[model samples]
Target chain A: MRISFSTTLMVCLTFVTLGCNDDQASVSLPESAKPLAVDATPYLVTTEPADTTPVGEARESLMDGESATLIGTIGGSSKPFIEGLAAFTIVDQKIPCCAAEEGCPTPWDYCCTQDQVKDNIATIKIVDESGSPVTADARQLFGISELSQVIVSGTAKRDDQGNLTLAASTIYVKP
Target chain B: MLLPWEYGVRNLARRPIHSGLTLFALTTVTLLIFVVVGFIRGLERSLAVSGDPNVMLVYSLTSEENIENSSISAQIPDLLAASLSATVKHFGITHHSPELYLGSRVTTADQSPGLGLVRGVTPTAPLVRRTVRMTEGTWPQPGEVMVGRLAATKLGVPTEVLKIGNQIEMEGQAWQISGTFAAEGASFESEIWCDLSDLQTATKRQDLSLVAMLLKDRTASSEVDLFCMERKDLELRAVRESEYYQTLQQHYRPVRILGWLIVGLVATAGIFAGLNLMYGALAGRIRELAMLQVLGYKRVAILVSVVQEGLVLASAASLIAGTFAVCWINGLTVRFTMGAFALRIDSLAILSGCAVGLLLGILGALPPALKALHASVAINLKAV
Candidate 1:
C-alpha cells in the first residue's frame, strides 16, 4: 500500500513538473509588415472646380458611374479618414460641424446634427488606375483634418441602398 | 471456478465502517463535480437563451458593447416607427421597445438595501422580448412595479420580499410590486421592471437606454441597418440580439474553462483517494485472495470480485449524490455580475457526475487488484 501510494504521488509530481516547464518555454513572435505607400500628387488640384455641388444634393441626384464635382467639409464621423485606404467621408457645408454651436469635443463627427448628417455626407475615395482606393491612410496623403472644407471632382458610384461614393480624380484643398 | 457474486457483497458487509467511508468519499467528490458543472451549465444557458435572433437592438455607439450603458434619444423609437413603418409594424401597432436599464440599490420592507438590476420598460417590451410571460399578476400599472421570478435572489432577500403586492423602494421612492414575470429562464428574470415613463420621472432621465425591435424576419435586419446608416445623426448602431449575447458568452469563455478544469482536478483527486482506499482494503485481504486461489479458483476470479466490490460502492455513492443534487442543488439561485441564474443540475451535469463515479471505481480497483494478483498463491497463503 505504501509503495502504491508513493508511485501514484510520483506520477502526479512528474505531471505537475512537466506542466510547469511547458509554461516557461519561450515563444518567438513574427515581425509586423510595413504599411503600403500611396501617392496622391497626381490627383491633387491647385484650383477648385468651376461647378460645385453640395454633398446632400449630389447624394440625391447623382446616379452610379456619373461625373460630379461635390463640395463639402471634411467632417462626419469622429474619424473621417479611413485607415490604410485613401478615403474620407465629407459632410455638406450647409450643416454646421458643431465647433461653434455646441462646443462638441469631436465636432468633426457632427454628432449634434447626426439626424440630417447622413444625407449630407458622402464618401470620397482617391482611386488608383486599377480603381481601388489608394493603399495608404487618407490623413497621411491629403494632410487634411476634420472641418476642413474641400472640393472633390469625381465619378459618383451609388450602391443599391443609394449611398454615394466619389471616386475622386481631383481634390482641391481649401486655403 | 469463479467466486459467487455474493462473495463481493459479503466482503463489503464484513467491513461496514471501511466501506461506508469509501462511499462517503466518492459521494462527496461526485457532488462537487455536480456543483461545478451545474454552475457552468447555468451560466451558459442563461446567456444562450437570452438572445432572440429575429430581434434587433438599436443603441448608441458611444456605449460601446454594453447596452445598459447606451443612451439614445427617446424620440428615436418613434422615428424608427415612422421611417420604417412597413418593417417596424406587425398588423397595426409598432414592435419597438424603448427602455431604460440600469443597476441601482433597492430596499425591501424587511430587508436592507441591496444592489438590484432594474429596467424601465413599456408594454411594448414584450413585443421584442418574446420570452417574457406574466407568471403572476398583471403588467405594472402607473406607480406599481413588476418583479422577475429571480429578482428576490438577485437582491439577496427572501423570496417573500418580492411576492406580488409587496412594496419595494428604489431611487428614493416606494413602489408596490404589482406582479412577477419570467423570461423563460433568461437573464431578464433577475431584473425589476416598471413603467418606462415612471422610471424616467423617478430617475429624472429623458433619454432611453436602447430600442429593441422585432423584425419581420432575419433578412429585415438589413433594412434596420440601412436606417441606422442613413440616420447617422441618431449615432445608432444595430445588432442582432442573438449576436450580442453570443459575444457575451465568448467574453465568459475563460470562466467556463476554469470551471471545467476544477471538475477535472476534483475527479483526479477522487480517483487517487479511491486508489488509496482500495490498496488498504486489498492489503488485509491478500491472504484471503490467495486462499481462494488455492481453493481451485483462478487469480482472475478473485480480482473480479475485488473490482465488483469497488464498483458496487462507487455506484451507490453516485446514486446517493445524484439524488441529493437533484433534490437540493437543482434550480438553486446563484448571483453573478450579469444578475442571478439557477444552478442547473440538468441531465448533462447528472450524467457527468455518474461518469466520474464509475471512473473512480474501475480505475481505482484495477491497479491495486493487479498488484495483489502478481504474488504467487504459495507465497500469499503462507503469509497469514
Candidate 2:
C-alpha cells in the first residue's frame, strides 16, 4: 500500500510537471544552412537613378524596395553584429550638430526628452543578389568602422514592424 | 512511567479511520507552510540571480525611468565606451550593448491577454549579460523574435508548447519565433527579445533604455557611477543591476507580506482542526484510559500514551505531505510582474514544515490528554 501510494503520488506530480514546465529544450528549431561568406570588395558605384536622400528622409521616405543613396556616419560600430545577423544602424553626420537644443546628453531611447529622437539614424544590412542578409557581415568583410562617413545605396524596406532598413547593393566611402 | 511504545502505536491502529482523518488534517497545515516558505525563497533567489554588479543601468535621471520610457542619445554607447573604467569589459567585445525595453499586452496561444516585456537588444547584449545562452535556434533576425524560456509562462501558456515555427502577432504584425534563450535563475528568461532596430521601427520610438557592460573589478561600479554624475548634462544615472532588483523587491513587498498573513491564518485553523480531531479520537476512549489505570499502569503512563499517539499521527501526515511537496511543489515556476521564478523547496523549507507538523500534533493532543488523565477515574469507571 505504501509503494502504491508513492507511485500514484509520483504519477500525479509528473503530470503536473508536464502540464506547466518552462523548459524549452524539447522544442526543436527548423534546419538552417551554414552562414554565407561575404564579398571582400562588394561595394559598386551604381547608377540606378538613386537620390542622395538624407537619413531623416529615409525614415519617412519611399516604400520598401525603392533604391536610394544615403550619407551617414556609421554608429554602433564597436560591435555591429553578434554572429548570425549582420546588420548595422548608423546616425547621420548632422545628428551631433542638433545637440545644442533643449536637451544635452539624451537618455539613449530619446523618446522621453523634449528634443526629438534623431531621425537621421538608419538601419542598413548588406544583402546578396536575392536581397537576403549576407553571412559575412559589413564589419567582418569591409571593416565598416563606427562613426565613419559613407554614402550607401540600397533598397528601402520596412520590416513588418515598419522599422526602416536599407538593403545595400553598393556602399561608397567618402573620399 | 511511560506506557510501552507498542501500546500507543497499537491504540492508533485500532481506529484506522480516526487516525487517517487526523493525519490528513495535520498534512494540510504542513503543506501550506511549506508552499509559503518556498514562494519567499523563490522570490529572493530570482532577485539574487539577476544582474551584474558592475553593469550599471545608465538611463534618464528621472524617477520614472523604466525600460520603455527612458530614452537617450544614439551616441550613448560610444560615450560610455570612452569612459574606460579598468574593471569594465564586454567579454570578447569592445563596447557595451544599447537596449530598448517595452512592456506591452501580448495575446497567448489561447487568445488571452498576457503581459510581455519585449526587449530590443543589440548583439552585444549577450556580452554584457554573460549569463544568457541560446537553448534553441540562432540569434534573431530582423523579422524574427526569440522568446525566453519562461516567456510563455508569463504569458499564461506552456513554454514547451510555444513552438519555434509559430508566429506571434503584436500591433497587427506577426513575428516568427526563431529561437529561445535561458538566463539561469535570472528574470530575463521571461522576456521576448528581437533585433533592436526592428523593435524601434515597430514601436516607432527610435531610442534606447540603457547600456550594459560586464564588470570584472568589483569596485568598478562606483567609478561608472562617478562618470554618470559628472555627465549631468547627459541626464544619465548609474544603477547596479542587483541593487535595482533589491529595490524592485520593495515593489513586491506587499505581495510577500500578504502571503505570510494567509499562511498564518490557515496554519491557525489547521492546528484547531487537528485539535478537534484529537478530542473526538480520545472522547470515546475515556473508559479505556480508566481501565488502563485500574489495571496497574500509572496515570502518567496513560497520558504519555495519548500524547505519543498524537506525535505518530502528525509524523505520518507530514510524511505524506513531504512526499507530495518533493514530487510536485519543488522547482515549479511562479509568474509575476518582473518575470517568472521557480519555486524552491530547499532543505530549510522542508525542515520548517516538519517542525510545524510536530508543533500542531503537540498542541492538538495536549488539552484532551490532560483532561482524560485528571478527570475522575472512579466516576468514569462507575459511569461505564
Candidate 3:
C-alpha cells in the first residue's frame, strides 16, 4: 500500500513538472515605424521635368538636401516597390534589367547586372508635409507599375554611403 | 471503512495474465507519447538554438526569405566589413562571413547519390557561427570538406562513409573529408561545409547567398539595419539570426500541431483500451465487491481499491517505458526539409509520458467504477 501511494505521488509530481513550458525568447519589431498619409494627385504632374539627370549620374553628383530632377525606369530589384510604403527602386536606363535575357523569370530584378546595380540604382519615396514616406503602396498611388518610365523631382537624401533616396514632391508618369 | 490496500494488490496478483496484459498496453501507449513529444521538442530546440542573439544575417531582400535562393554581389561582405567596422569587429578581426548556401546531389564512394544541404564558407564563418566546434581532424583546406555530425543522417548515408580521409562527390567535384563538426545541436549540424572559393569555382557561380556577421552587442543590430536601409540599391535585408529562426519555427507550426494531434489520438485509444480492461476486471469482482460493501466496507472504499490496482500497474508501466525511451529514442535522428535533428527525450518528455500513464489509469477506470457503484447493494449481493 505504501509503495503504491509513493508511486502515485511521484507520478503526480511528474505531471506538475510536465505542465511547465520553456519560454522561447524572440526579438521584437522596431518601434520607429510611424503612420504616413499623402495625396498622390497633388504631387502628380503631366509635364516631365527639364534637364533631368540620369539616375547613375545624379547619384554621383547629388549632395544631401540638393534639389534635382532624376529620370529612370521603374525597376532595379525583384521587389522594387516597398510594402506598405510609397517607395520603389529605379535603375539607370543604361543598365539592362533581365527583361531581354533568355529564361529570366524575374526580369525587373536586374539579376544579370547585379555587379553594376549598386552604382546605378536609386530609391524614390513620396513624402508628405512632415517628410515621412507615405504609408500607402507606391504601385496604387503612382498609377504605374514595374518597368514604367517616369521622372521624379525631389530633394536628394544622401547618406554617408552615397546611396540616394529622392524625397519626391513631383512625379510625372509617362504616357 | 476503506478496503485495505493489500486487497487490491492481492487481487492483481491472483490474475497474473490479465494484469500483465494491462501493464503491456499502458507501456506501449506511454512510450508512443514519449516518442511524439520528443520529436516536437527536438525540432523546436534545433531551430531555437540555431539562432544566436548576437549574430545578424544580410541577404538579398528579393529572395523572399529563402536564403538559399538569394544572390548578391560578392563584394557585399567586404563592403559591410568596411562600413560597419566599428561595431562589427572584435580583436581587430571583422566578424563577417560570406557564404554560398544551396542543396545539391552528394555521392559518397560506397553510397548512392542523395540530395544534401551544402554551405560554402570562409575561415571567418566560425567567428559568426560561434556554436560550431570542429570535433575531428582539421578545417577544410582548399579541396577538402568538413561534414557536420548529423551530415550523414541528412544525406542518407552511413556514419562510417563520412569519416576523415573519405571522399564525397558534389557539384561535379570529389572532395576529401577534412573533419567533422557539431553545432551544439543546431540545424547547422546537418550541413556539409567547404571553402567558399572552391565551391564557387566548381559551380561556376560568382555571386554569394548571404553574409553572416557577429555583432559586438544586441545594440549593433540597428547599425546593420541602418546599412541595409541606406544601401537599398543593393536590395539587401538585414535580419537578426534569432529572429530568422523564430520565423522558421512559426513556418513549421503546422507540423508541431500535427504532432500534438497524434498524441491526443493515441492517448484516446489508450483510454479506450484501459476502459475495456477495467470493465473485464470489474465483471469478475462484482460479487466480491458486493460482499465487501455488505461487510462494513463502503461502496466508495471498493471503488478506491479498484482505482489503486489500475494506478499501480500504470506507474510500473511508465517507469519501464521511460527507461526505454531515454535509452533508444533520445538523440535518434529525424530528417525534414530544413535538415535532420535528433529526437530529444529530455526530462520534459519523460514527465509527459508519466502524466499520460497516470491519465490512462484515472480516466479509464473511473466510468466503470462509478457505474458499478450506481447499482443498489441488494442487487449486487444477489449476483450468481
Candidate 4:
C-alpha cells in the first residue's frame, strides 16, 4: 500500500510539473486591433505591399498594363506641388551624373507624371485625369509635406507631350 | 513477493533474444507514433504562428485553390475605405495597405527553373507582418527586389546567392537584389517581393492577389464579415488573418488522420508481438509460479510482478526511442504545398511516448498474467 501510494503520488507530480506548455505563446492581436468605430474619413486603402519603384524611374518605363507603388513625397515646396484637389506633383529622385551631378533626363520628357526640372531639381504633377486636370482638393487627396511619404499604384501612360502620366489606381499618404 | 521488481530485470537478462526482440518492437512503435503525431502538430503550429488576430485578409469572392489565383480591381481598397470603415483614415495613421500577389517562376544562377511565389507590395507589407526585419540593404526599387531568406532555399538556390547585388530573372525580365528580410518564421518568408507596377507589367496581371488590413478595432472583423456577406456586388470575403490559417489546419485534417491511422496500425502490431512473447515465456514459468504460490505467494502478487516486468521493458524502450527522436529526427524540415515546417520533439511528444509506454505495458502483461494466475498448483506439479 505504501509503494502504491508513493507511485501514484510520483506519477501525479511528474505530470503536473512537466506538462506545462512550452509554446503557449499567447497570440494576442495588437491593441489597435480592438474593434472601433470605422472612422468615416477620406482614408488611404492598403493592400499587401508590392515592389517599390522610384517615382522618376517608373515615369521612364511607361510599360503598358504596368502598375506599382511610387514611394516619395506627394507634395513639397522644394520641387513637387499640388495644382488643385485633383492634380498634384511628386519630386523624382536624382542620380549623380558623372561626379558633376548635373546629368538627369529632361523632367518634361518622362512619360509617368508631368513635372519640370529647374536648377537640377525635377518635379512632376499627378493628375486625376492625365492631361485634363479637373478641379479636386489635391492637398486633401494627398497630404502635402516634404515628409508626406506617399505611395501610389497605377498604370503608366504617356501624354501627348511625351510626358509620363500615371493613372493612379490606389494612393497611400504616409500616416 | 515471489519475484520482486528487480527480478524482472534479471529475467530479461536470462532470455536475451526474446527480451531484445520485445524491446526492439516497442522502440519501433514508439518512434513511429512520435513522428506521425509530431509532424501534424508542427504543421498546425507553423500555420497558426503566421497570422495576427487583428489583421484581416480580403480577397475576391471568386478566390479559390490558392491566394495567387485571386484577382481584384486595384481600386478595391478605395471602395472598402468608403463603405466598410471610416476609422481607417482617422488621424492620418494609415492602416490600410494593398498587396498584389503573383505565382511566377524563378531561374536559379545555375540556370535551373523552378516554381516561385512573387508578391508586389508597398513598404507597408513588412509593417503588417510585424516580425519582418530587413536584415541587409535598402528597400527595393523598380529594377530591384527584396528576397525573403527562406524563399532562397525554396527556390533551389543557395541563400547566399540571393544576397544584395545578385540578380534573378522572371518572365524574361531581370531583377537585381536589393535586400533580404526575416519574418520570424512567418509565411511571408517564402516569397519574392517587387514593385507592384513592375510585377503587373512583367506578368501582364492587372489584378491583386489579396489585401491585408489592420482594422480600426477588434470588432471590425465582425463588421467586415457582415460587409462581405452583404456586399455581393463587390464579390468580396473577409476573415481575420489568424482564423484563416485555422481553416487551413482543418483542411489538412485528412493528412493528420492518415498519420494517426498508420500509428494505430503499427502500435497494434507491436502489442500483439509483445503479447506472444509474454505468453510463451510465462507458459514455461507456470510450474515455478505454482511452486511459489504453494510457498505462500499470493496469486495477485505474482500478477503484479509480471506487469511490473512489462512496464520496465517499455520504459527502457521509451528512453532509447525518445533519445533517437530528439537527437536525430528533431528539427528535420518538411516542405508542404504552402511552406516548410520543422519537426519538433517538444514536451507533448515526450508525454505521448510515455503514455504509449504505459498502455503497452498493461496490454503486453495482461493475458499471460491471467493465464499464470488461473493455473492450479496440483495441475502444475503433475504436469512437470
Best by TM-score: 3
Q: Please give the distance, in angstroms, between residue B359's alpha carbon in candidate 1 and its true position after superposition.
A: 0.3
Name the weakest run of 10 consecutive residues (lDDT summed) in model 1 chain B. Answer: B225-234
Off by over 4 Å in 1: A1-175, B85-88
| Least accurate 10 contiguous residues by lDDT in model 4 chain A | A114-123
Q: Residue-wise lDDT of candidate 4 within A1-175, one digit each (tens)?
A: 9989989998896777477646676686542333433221333455534686776666565564565566654432222333222334454545221222444333222322223321112123333434333233445443444435566666665433334445564566667
User: In what order do the candidates fall by lDDT, top score first?
Assistant: 3, 1, 2, 4
Instruction: For candidate 3, write residues A1-175 as lDDT tens digits.
Output: 9889989997887676655656444466432233335467877898777999999999899999999999999887666776556778788999987756378878888888888888988888877768866666667777788899989999999988678989997889888
Candidate topping lDDT: 3
Global Cα lDDT for candidate 1 = 0.85
DockQ of 4: 0.04
Q: Model 4 off-target regions past 4 Å?
A: A1-19, A22-175, B64-66, B78-93, B110-113, B133-169, B173-184, B222-232, B378-384
In candidate 3, which residue pairs clash?
none
lDDT score for residue B13 of model 1: 95
- Candidate 2, residues B231-314, lDDT tens digits: the string is 435667667786688787777789889877877787788888987888888888888888898888897788778888898888
Q: List ranges where model 2 is wrong by over 4 Å.
A: A1-175, B90-92, B108-110
For model 1 chain A, give the 10-residue run with minimal summed lDDT: A23-32
In angstroms, how far off is B22's CA in candidate 4?
A: 2.3
Instruction: Report the lDDT tens digits of candidate 4 across residue range B218-278.
Output: 6556446544533334557666788788788788889889877887886787788789888
* Candidate DockQ scores, in order: 0.04, 0.01, 0.17, 0.04
Q: Each model's C-alpha lDDT?
A: 0.85, 0.72, 0.87, 0.67
